[model samples]
Target: MEFPPLPLFTEVELKSEIARVATFKKVPKGETLIRQGQYLKVLPIVVSGAIRVFQTFEDREILLYYVRANETCIMSLTACLFNNESASYAITDAPTQVLYIPSDYITDWQTRYPSWNKFILAAYRNRYDELLHEFTDAVFKKMDERVLDYLRNYRDTHSVHTIPISHQALALELGTTRVVISRILKSFELEGLIGLHRGSITLKKPF
Candidate 1:
């Protein structure tokens, strides 16, 4: 299949320039896309499937954000622009297709391509929007509410109600402990909000 068309290039430019500049990769689920502290020589543009970017602490990890179809990771761009290494890990959540454009092209294309400059600014805008959303949830939303939001978004995105994840996994995703998440889950079950099964959580009502 043709790679997803990027707005970074006009149709005529895409046909000649962008296609020539990008290298493509197909990856399977669970594949590591970028490792923490790894050198970034290219900018990853996800054309299909999902990638999870997460930060690792001494004994825990928290999801930083997700990049999926039509989206790019701002940190990846930052690393390339600043000559810094990737500070977080990125892994494929499902079979994925990515377009890797060489880092050198970032600066060069900005002056050479109007769309590239727009896309660069847009990436920062998107990152700010995402950070604000996360901050709002952290400061204003309750843990149970955040859990529900996460599950709801996951279900809508993946088109599934049965989420195959452990309590520990949920805890990590929400930046909390397993014990606390387990307790909240139990409460959800008692309240007819969810159903908990081994290695999974099922929504009992529309969220």
Candidate 2:
């Protein structure tokens, strides 16, 4: 399938330039798009599916945010603009198609193209809000509450009640141990809030 066009830059010249230089690729689930400590050479825009961005410390990983269709990774944009190594890594959460714009033109376009500048600033603002919300949740919410929120968010994002994910994978994303997540999931199942399967969990009621 042809890569979906980004509605970011409205200027005919800017849009044409992007289409001329940007490359698209399809990646399977679990494919790493960016690695921590590596300098970014391109800024990726998600055309479809999702990419999970996260940081890892001492073998434990915590999710920063997800890049869904029509969205780009602000962290990648920052690294590309500043010529710095990435602080976090990104992996495809599902089969995904991404449009990669070479880093060479990012900063130049900011000053040369008004629409590009606006798009970049807007991306930054959106990502900042998401990060702030994540920080607040981490500071104020209990583990069980956080898990419930994660499940609910996933359900809403994917438009599905049944989430096909492993407990271990969920724990990694939540920055917790699998045992703890399993216990909490079991409790949720007992409470009739969810139904836990061997490799997935189904939401039974709206929360």
C-alpha root-mean-square deviation, each candidate: 1.7, 1.7
* Model 1 ranges with Cα > 4 A deviation: none
lDDT of 1 by residue, 78-146 (tens): 899898988999999988999898898888878877777777788789879999999999999999899
Give the Cα error of residue 103 in candidate 1, in Å: 0.6
Clashing pairs in 1: none
TM-score of 1: 0.93
> Which pairs clash in the backbone of model 2?
none
What candidate 2 gets wrong by more than 4 Å, as runs, is: 1-3
Q: What count of clashes does model 1 give? A: 0
lDDT of every model, 2 decimals: 0.87, 0.89
> Using Cα atoms with residue i matched to residue i, what is each candidate's TM-score against the true structure?
0.93, 0.91
Which is the leading candidate under lDDT? Answer: 2
Q: In model 2, what lDDT does residue 205 have?
A: 63
Q: What does the lDDT read for residue 90 in candidate 2?
A: 96
**Residue-level lDDT for 61 in candidate 1:** 92
